[model samples]
Target: MSNPPELPEFPSPFNFINNVPITLVELRMRNFSGQIREKPRWWEKVHDADIVAKWRSEIIEQDEKVVEQFWGGEKRFDDGNGEKKWPREKITGAQLDYIFDELKDLAQAIDHETGIQRTAIDKVYQSKTLIPADLKTVFLSGVSILESVPPEEQDWHPGANDQVLDLVHPSLHCFRIGRSPVLIPERTSGCPDPLFVLTEEQYLEMREDAEGAIVSQFISTNYQWLPTDFEVSQPGRRLYSNITSILQRFLPLFERVLSDSSDPPPPLAVAANPGGWYEDEESESDLSDDEMDARWRKFHWPVIHDPAPFSPPTQEGRTPLSLNGRKLQVIIKLANIVLTPERPKYPGGSWHVEGMVNEEIVATGIYYYASDNISESKLAFRAAVGDGTDEAGVSWNYEQSDDRGWTVAFGLRQWRSMNQELGSIMATEDKSSLGRGRYSAFSLSTRRGPSSRRATFPAATIVVPRRAGKVPALRALPQEIWDMIMQYALAGTVSLEEAKQDRLALMEERSHFVIEHNREIFEVEFNMCEH
Candidate 1:
């Protein structure tokens, strides 16, 4: 083998992952720089077991006393003539009004910026859009306050039963739900917040409720701290009104954020290309007929096809694989092909190759031989006999077959599954040509044979029809598609059985998706290793 090309320089350790300084904004929010160490308590230093035990007992007693007085003490306000029971500190109508005012000021500040001053605001807005809308919808479903009284648990606020907040995601800087309800009894904190002490039965019921209930619930029966407007027999109208007013103030913000990001980019297309190495035009001339045969045998002899040490080089200019001047049998697996329709017009195509591997699928795809005599290597593709629908399928067995659909050249690599061109075609919707073929296009296999072999069809020979729209074709292969191809290449060729064992081993490994940004590109990465 020849000396390999020099690898690209690795990026520096402190290099910015991307141009965005959003990381700085996130770090600032955490305020790690301002964190202070706490002084250790006297009990922490007391090694004497008896003394430590006494301190713990005393602390527990004091905590109990505090809880009792906060709940039971009748702290009264001395009015000029009479004493009235002091109301517990719960979210009141006035507090709601204050919250709205504060939020209004923030929104106004966000909208007031111009030119350079708007940079921070724009970054924040862009960051907000990164979160998914379905996730926001889930959070905005709001909270349910469940009240557990002795053996029975009921919703504390009845209005919550029928109300869906339709509020913005808390992460969008709209507003955050305050302290979560704690699972303990305390003097200052109680039921109005949906704060709760869960009983075994209530916990089980909550587990059953799950996502089906739509809203989150916290159960506690301490209704004494509830707002004055809450009559024991009725829904807390005043408290509901306050919450309604506060959420109403945030409606415009949510509307603006959602509207600005209404249309999202289409999902990335991903596939496992079971094909072998993709070579370029530059490498073919160097090999003699005997040398080529040896190389082919080396590549295909392994039970699991491994495609390492080579890839379709972007610099050398990739070309289609040549079939050594021989008319070879091409078996196309309908299951390996991707199609546009959701409820596909043709179903059960996968059964054609239910128990086979990539090597078994011939005519996986046809390719131009990258020379003047392109026609000899190019195989004729036609609609397979018998199958009449626009669905992708072709006959692998000729004697037992009749009609089929159009076939296209699949991949330049031995594994046609990695062909991005084919993927794009599969992803596209075809335009009706008034029953006339205007140009040329590719297609997948169709129609099952009586035997176990997957349906086969010739690719690359059909005259494609004219496409409907002016959708701009991709100028360069997307990084995502390229990376996926590389991953398949590195994984080498492994048969289904080898793949199963490796998957089991992977189950025991720690893995996570790592994302890295390169200027305009975001690369999502995962390792496919065989341990």
Candidate 2:
């Protein structure tokens, strides 16, 4: 046949073949181009076939030489004798190259699901008649090399080539690619060791997540041991502020989480948690117990002391906001008066406030519904006035806990001064003087309200001392002398010159009368002449 003339150019390369118009055979060839004409692509061996086998073998041979060099031409076989041992040394660039170069040894079959032998892979790649396949492989050989090298043997000093690190990083497989899990390297190098295997972004992200978790843990459990502003570093400052901001933002959710009484909490759509810079050493470490305790008291006490922004408790019809300020003030004043006989030092009472406001004691009583003996409205408080009793052996009216019952009592002798009301208040076995007298010493008998076993203060009832039937002998003093005595008692002052010249001064100087409240009255007669 005569030589066929050239066909007209078509839009695509497969539009025509052998000087003929487009056909099925040409289309088939176009669809599977490289299968019929196999070309060995060594560059793509890692993802295709074992063309890089030679490269892998060479790198392994080089690694052996590098190992020899590391030992200074002397090898130790660990002969189980104490006589000879190899000294620890840093790795070299040549060793790093050999370690990373072994990545080429891995080969996958045409299906890319299982491993294939290097010999079979080589045949698949070089065979001219063999069909092309996506014979991808996972490069575990380099990972094996890295895993074999101990961390101590790695050169961890700075000043390594960035390109070399970049080349070695992909083989370490620190993270995942799609559904496949990556294999992290056992050995690392460079200052900030992760730099040898992780990108800066990845490293930063990991650190940030870790710091946030630490912050969360501290907020949940170690709030008492937080560091103070003076003791905190710059990063710690950021951590504190960040945590505070996060708390403020999600305070309601946290309150709900905390208040949930059920076994399994209801599902909540949590907000994006903010990150912080709380130092792991300061918050997470167990070292320096005393120092941590001090810091916790210094830094976190204020939060515990105030805590107004958080959820305020509620009583009958009152809220914590209404009760905390003026109400607390009134309670504190009365507590001071009722608790002072035995409590020489005043650090303020442990007044737990629930709710507030109104005119009379009856209408304004903080109602507490006791679910059970142990379960009462959160609006209750327990206070301690004195260590024990006054000289007269009468216990100062205050809260006391025992195995059987917990006596929670409070009274204000001068209720008018506090601008507080009184009403149907409960009494305990110990007997409180909180009676329904407008201005009289209001005392409530202990056994009047609830059983001593449960010791539940009645709802809508206040605890006050009942009025004493007899006036304490200290009140029997003449008003003038009593006023002088009170002034002297308050001032804790005495002078001889003033005593001889003035009646008030004489009373103050001649006698040291200790007016004991909440107990029997007694007077101490003093003779200045004796002194």
Residue-level lDDT for 304 in candidate 2: 7
The TM-score, computed over Cα atoms with residue i paired to residue i, of candidate 1 is 0.16
The clash numbers for all candidates, in the given order, read 34, 26
Per-residue lDDT tens digits of candidate 2, residues 1-531?
Answer: 443232221111101111111111111112122221122443245443343345445444544554354333323221112221111122233332322232233222231321111221111111111111221011122222422456554322122221011111111211211211111333212212211223334433433222432222211110010011122454345433432332232222221221221122222111111111112334748648897766643333100011112122233432111111111111100000111222212122122121111101111121111112221111111111222212111222212211011000011111111111111122221111211121112122232344222221111221111211111113344475446445534443324333223333222321221112111111111111111
Candidate 1 residue-wise lDDT at 467: 16
> Candidate 2: global Cα-lDDT?
0.22
In candidate 1, residue 227 scores what lDDT? Answer: 10
Q: Indicate the worst ten consecutive residues by lDDT in candidate 2.
A: 402-411
TM-score of each: 0.16, 0.12
